[model samples]
Each structure stands twice: as C-alpha cells, then as structure tokens.
Target: MVRRIETDRLILRTVTVDDAEDIFKWASDPDVNKFMIYPLHKDIEVTKEWLRSRDIDGNDEFDLGFVLKETGELIGQGGIFYKEDLDAWAIGYNLRKEYWGQGLVPEAMKAIIDYVDKEKGIHAIVGEFAKDNSKSRRVMEKLGMTYWKDCQYSKFDGSATFDAYLYKREF
Candidate 1:
C-alpha cells in the first residue's frame, strides 16, 4: 500500500481523482509546465484521466499529492519510479507557482528519498530537469545528488523536446 508521509508543513499522500482541480491549478499554469514533460492540462478531465492511469499502489511506483498541513490543500505532486532502461529509481516533482522558492519540494523529496532508502533498500536515485530550470537543479543539489549528464528530453505527447540535465545520488 502507498504510505502517507507527513512533514512539518506538508502531507505526501497518494493522488486521488478528487484532487483534479488542485492539480489542474498547477498543471495548467504556463510557469509550471514550462519545463514539464507533459503539456498543460486543458481540462479537469485530463487531470482525472492522468491520475487514473498512475500506478500509485506502492508496489510499482508512487505518484503522491503534496498537501499543506495547515490548509489541507494539495500544493503539488512528487514521486519516484523505477526506470528499467536506466536501471535506477528516478524522482520528480511539480508545484504551483505561488509555492515556488519555498523549499517545499526539497522537503517533500527528502522524505520520499529517506522512505525509499529505508523501506526499499534502494540507493540509486536519479533526477532530471530542463537545463533552464535552475530552481529544480538547486533541489537536486540540496539533496547532494551529483550531476550525471545531459540528455534529450521529449514530451509525453511528442510535442516538444529540450536538453535535460541528469543528477544521481547513489548510496
């Protein structure tokens, strides 16, 4: 089962269909989508459909909703998944523009990384971000993840391509 994680100010729980609206808030924002692999969600149905397709059962991977503890609002999403091709567990996250520069992503990410290391005994965690996303890169750096390499990135729908910098933390 997917475990619910709690930080001092946030709750990281499995995504639900009910979270579509909040998800769309950021998923549709141009600033948030500027570096993401998926296009901006044009409708709530799109977010709902995407949530339905995610395998958040805890057996495979986790795509969690990051909720604010004080307001009980989902501020973002974060997850780690095993990549067969790279033979490593890859991590990612997205947050609403208003929450940017708050150090929330790193807090949530650190919780996930710790959980995975303890429960899964997996140490190879990788991350990648658009080269232009310095904020994201800073998160990786804060995690002490080392720069791996740069690779080509394509949107899920094949609508765009960009250079992506990869980082990895191996225990």
Candidate 2:
C-alpha cells in the first residue's frame, strides 16, 4: 500500500494504473526521463504494465504520485525506498519540466522524510543524483542533505551509466 503525504501545494498518494495517462505526460518526455533509470515509455500500456508490477507494499518502497492540490493534476512520481547497502532510506523523484525550480521537490520530499522519521524512526535518509544533474543536486542540498560520497548509478536496463554523488541527512 502507498502512503498519503500532503503538502501545502501538493498531495502525494498511491500511484495506480489509473494514473498512467497523467504520468505519461512526463514519463514520455525525453528531457524529463533523461536522467531516470527506466526506459522512455513508448505507450500508456507500458506504464500500466509497469504499475501493475510495482511493489509498493514490500521492498520498503512507497511509490506515489505528486498531485497538484489546486487543480488535482498529477505532475510527477517518486518516493522513498529502503537502501539495504546504506541501512537507510533513499529518496528519488522526477517532475514535469514545467514544475522545475518551483521548490515543490523539497516541499514534497521533506514531507516524506518527516513521515519516515516519524513512522520508522529512520536514523538517516539519503538522496543521490547524477553529477551532471544540477537541479537534483540542489534539491538534495535544499532538503538539508549533505554530500556523503561519490557514487555511480546505471539505468535499470543497464543501457547507460553515470557518475553520481550520494547525499545524506541524519535525524
């Protein structure tokens, strides 16, 4: 099950196959998916199939849709998941390009972090970004995450790889 997290400007809630259309708006955008691990969705069915396979209950993954409170539009998707290697939760997000720089990333993520801290008593939270992704780096920094180490990440399909930085904040 997905958790519901509310912010002043957004509501993050369970993302289902019903959200494929709205999510595809950004999922299919090359610029938006450029740094993402998943392949560019060629059609809505791919998204629906993906959603059907998503494991939100187990794996300590609470994937959710970021919905605008004002108009109830799904703008993006992301959430926190357990990172076994770090023995901590790791954060991840992807937003519509139009929504970038509006500070929603930090707003939404802080809510998730706070929820995790309250519910799980997490000692530490982490966020990682490609070195070339300045916007993501800033989001981590704004969320009070400090650079922890140099890291590397790859696309889910292993089609591409990138040098990244791991950022962490301890509660």
Best by TM-score: 1
lDDT of 1 by residue, 43-118 (tens): 8899999988876675648667899999999999998888878888899999999999999999999898787777
CA lDDT for candidate 1: 0.88
Error of 2 at 143 (Å): 0.9
Deviation of model 1 at 22, angstroms: 0.7
lDDT of 2 by residue, 1-171 (tens): 657989999998988888889988888899998888898988989888998898877647766788999999999887898888899899999899999999998899888778767877788889888899999999999988999999999989888899999999987
Clashing pairs in 2: none
Give the residue spans of candidate 1 off by over 4 A.
Answer: none
Clashing residue pairs found in predicted model 1: none
